[model samples]
Target: MNLHADAVTVLSAWAPSLGSQESLRQAFLGFLATRDDTVQRSCEAGHLTASAVVLDSTGTQVLLTLHPRVGRWLQLGGHCEPSDASVADAALREATEESGMTGLEIGAAPVHLDVHPITCSLGVPTRHFDVRYAVRAPAGALPVRSDESDDLRWFPVDALPAGSEDLAELVNAAVSSH
Candidate 1:
């Protein structure tokens, strides 16, 4: 199937009752219909990005990266690479790379979907349709900061560092699901 069709299939199969998730599902459907570069980084309008909410073995803590560009404590995720076979695979790969955890387990369905604006490395303003999945790290897993982040740390699920309210919501959804 084509990328847009594949995205429709993925989102249609995901049963999310939350208002945000529902809105995102609808918006993604529209985006797919109107935009051809759903998986390309150079899409000035916007493109799909995958992210992972990495939780500890007990699910009480979550790993967050201090994104240098955004300067926020956010989930471990990034642009969708050409090698990614699915959105979930992109999220899993990003989580493993950022968290330095070898045995990370990621859920098949996305736990959250968000569309937000940002500036890409190419210095172009763009939007990202983020598909976020829940990922569980092995016990006592420690994250290592990559070039994409300024710092990497684990925070209690209830006591996330000061950041976006959306981050907290993502953690809640991930925690309950995984």
Candidate 2:
């Protein structure tokens, strides 16, 4: 299937809140409009990326990246490329790449979605419309930090690290979504 068709299929399957193709198309277009320059370029160039939050079987634990630049623990995700046929694929790909965990299994549906402004090392503004998904890793699978993260650790859902209220809310929502 083609990119647009694949996107339609995935969205139709997952986002039942969207009632029709026209609504889904509008939603997608609305998502596109919210992107910053970097993300806009990526989408225009057809290189949109995604990410996911991986949890253990009990759902009490979550894997987080200590972002090098942001200096905070966050879910694994990144830019979408041409190879990623669907948003879910992009999210799962980023999670695996960043966490270095094998046998990653992403849920068929998104747990939540959020858009936030990000400025890269060069101070270029970008908007990330993160399609956060619930994912599971094999038991005993250890996470190795990639260059994107200074450290990788599992945090208990009840005891999130110190951060902005917004982040706390996002984390809570993700946890509850599972």
Candidate 3:
């Protein structure tokens, strides 16, 4: 089967397991089956990627981003690219690039998997399959803003900004697992 067909097959098999949040599930399945060359190229080029949930010294605080485009606070992450040798590497790279924190230690297991819709300049939606990993931020690390984010800050797991429930859950899971 072709890539699109294979993607569809994979999506169909997994869609039933996605529970509610039908829109998110459908978009995720659609993303898996996308035949658009641009989208395919983006994924293939590693521009469609994964990310990390960096926990600070106390493990009570998690670093997050105030996204400029989506205008929402979220975990630091981005697309996986050709230079990334592995999924963990992609997550680490995105964390470093987006948060400017060095000496990050990525966890061995994925805490959660989420798919979100991102609309670019032309108002077309792209899907991001975020594979979230738990990570430890370097001691005394300070988060700095990058091109992808407007601001970076650390927030307590239970006291995250409004609308950050999903991120908070993921971060909490990661922390608990550790």
Structural similarity to truth (TM-score) of each candidate? 0.94, 0.76, 0.73
lDDT of each: 0.86, 0.67, 0.67
Please rank every candidate by lDDT, starting with the best. 1, 3, 2
Worst 10 residues of 3 by lDDT: 38-47
TM-score of 3: 0.73
Per-residue lDDT of candidate 1, residues 65-131 (tens digit): 9888888889999988877777888899999888777899999788999998888865888899998
Best-matching candidate per lDDT: 1
For candidate 2, the lDDT comes to: 0.67
Number of residue pairs clashing in candidate 2, backbone atoms closer than 3 angstroms, sequence gap of 3 or more or interchain: 4
Error of 1 at 113 (Å): 0.8
**After aligning candidate 1 to the native by TM-score, how far in Å is the CA of 46 from where it should be?**
0.3
Clashing pairs in 2: 48-80, 49-79, 49-80, 51-77
Which one wins on TM-score? 1
Candidate 3: residue 73 Cα off by (Å): 0.5
Task: Give the lDDT of residue 127 in candidate 2.
Answer: 53
All candidates: CA RMSD in angstroms? 1.5, 4.7, 5.5
lDDT of 2 by residue, 26-72 (tens): 56555544543323234432223466878876777788888888888
User: Between which residue pairs do clashes occur in model 3?
Assistant: 46-80, 46-81, 49-79, 49-80
